[model samples]
Target: MNNLKGPVRVVGTGLIGASIGLALGRLGVTVHLVDADAESALMAERIGAGSRDVAGEPQVVVVAVPPDHVGAVIAAQLAATTSAIVTDTGSVKSKPLVDAGALTDDLSRYVGSHPMAGSERSGPLAGRADLFDGATWAITPHEGNRPEAVELIRELAETCGARTVELSVQDHDLAVARVSHLPHLMSALAAGTLVDAPASHLELSGQGVRDVTRIAGGDPRLWTQIVAANAPALTTLLERIRGDLDRMLIALGKDDGSGDITNLLMNGVTGAVRVPGKHGAPHTDDATVLVNIPDRPGQLAKLFADAAASGANVEDLRIDHSPGLAIGQVELAVKPASVDQLVKVLTERGWVVHR
Candidate 1:
């Protein structure tokens, strides 16, 4: 695709918008960050996300607001940037598309997009330049959508290192309801159960519990808006999962290992294993080491340098930190065979190895 000359306007400086700005900026594309809150727009720009103000008409406009506000925001943005092609990163597309269509006659330049990538964080500060790397971005084009507009959005996703998957609006909602929305609801419910339990109960939690409830920490206001917007599809998917869960409970009550409940659980495990990795290949089970590093300048660089010097290819990394902590735990995922070598390397470099 040929590089467009005009600036790209991102109309919300949340995590998704800021990330898009960062990716576009890195591609030498001028980006204008526009948010209702001037502070948020300024913050995004300060973090190298984009320019602070909306310049003349942008070539492309991305609306990245909360679900509840996305439709109104997109309409406003479309009106403001009369000549620009518009798209959105809202989780639910049909509602916003319908709203935009009903509210305006200039629907030709609008396409709906949802990038299947995020962390349990919000706002510009939580934005990462590599957030969209190797993720799938869903493009939902309606009858009124211009081919050029859709292609431009696809190009944007490609530039940010995301694979483009075209889906009908209905299909996109259904798929995300099953894979994304349902899981968020489940995580929230699972975490809610522990609210009344004693604090000591948390100490006994294992990785399984942690993994299941991890997304529960996401912004509740944001999720509330999303779930409400996509309630129909999300509720439908949740009912299916609830039915399966009921069957499992009944099977356990009957003490019957021969029931179909085992198959249901096995299907979930198999489905999870089918999710592709960064290189678009199935992920393999691997071991990981947790290294505790002091929260000081250049500590992470030192650890990574030491790991490379010792000939360890870190497969993945997760950092756990808290406010004002002197140290943070870094979980380094690696090949099972390489764990020993990695530990040896870190220990030799005078770093604390937590296993």
Candidate 2:
């Protein structure tokens, strides 16, 4: 039966776990939330994630503990429940499979799934039912799993509002290393350099620096377990990055290097555009409209209204303002064809518009 008939038992009450509970609750499915920290489970229940009553046998057991604890938790849940289709939300899949496999042999009821959605923030209060909306969820079903068990997990993911991609365990680990784990490590490395910078240098920071280092603010203790679990894949990618750095340094040391730095920058441009746009399709053909607004209430609402008046659908947006500044810049991303009319309308309406 490829159904997410609950009560679904969620073994952790952190952001991802609590968000899953909240999402399932929207479907009127019963969710039983548990955590090593009792207070965490209570907080998750308080935030409408789920109940902490631990009632009824679970139809599905979702192991959402930290990466280091996921395998053991999965094994324990399998033993505790007789017929539940067990799954996990761990970012790294292979390690948990190995760990759980070592602790037990009856893995026919288990599948590994990772919902590629989370925030740099953690804890139950950070949970939101829509966290997985329009997000990608990877499903890695080992050979030991029953066919219907895999389908049930797929249903579980879709019920939580995510698109699913099935890949082998090795492939999933490698893919996440390049797209997720490596990027976090890179962000951490970049952010680490600014730790001891002068106050004057820090004052010049803008959206560029914030964009580069945003994920660096993630919980280091948690990320350490993830990074370590996926170390084999990450090491390969990091070595390639090291090679790129060495070449860049050599090119920079030379005078007037022909096309070396240019080629490096071009490589970046080539890669950046290939990243999928917000709609999850492989397209990035959107232009930005910048409008200056007063840093006051209702300005954003008024700006959006003005943009809508021009018949342009704002695909994405960001607001930027330095500390102590009374004005802000709003970057509105709209389709290219809509940009001209949007800009003209905003400019005619007394907004200081820029491309």
**Best by the lDDT measure:** 2
Candidate 1 error regions (>4 Å): 52-55, 127-130, 255-258, 285-312, 316-355
Full-model lDDT, candidate 2:
0.92
Q: Write the per-residue lDDT of candidate 1 for residues 1-355, one digit (tens) a residue.
A: 8645548888899899999989887788899898999999989999999888654889998999878788887888888877788899999988898777678877788889999898877889988888998889999988888788888999988887789999998899888887778889999999999999886777677667888998898888888888888888987887887898888877777856555777887888998888765466566666778888888899999999998887888888888764445878889887788888889988998988866
Those runs of model 2 whose alpha carbons end farther than 4 Å from true positions after fitting are: 54-56, 322-325
Q: How many residue pairs clash in each candidate?
A: 0, 0
lDDT of each: 0.85, 0.92
Q: Per-candidate RMSD vs. true structure?
A: 4.9, 2.1
Error of 2 at 213 (Å): 1.5
Give the per-residue lDDT digits (tens) of candidate 2, residues 1-355: 3377798999999999999999989999899999999999999999999899967689999999989999999999999989999999999999999999899889999899999999868899999999999889999999988888999999999999999999999999999998889989999999999999999999998988999999998888888999999999999999999988988999999998657989888998998877787776555677888899998899888899999999999988888877668988988989999999999999998899999
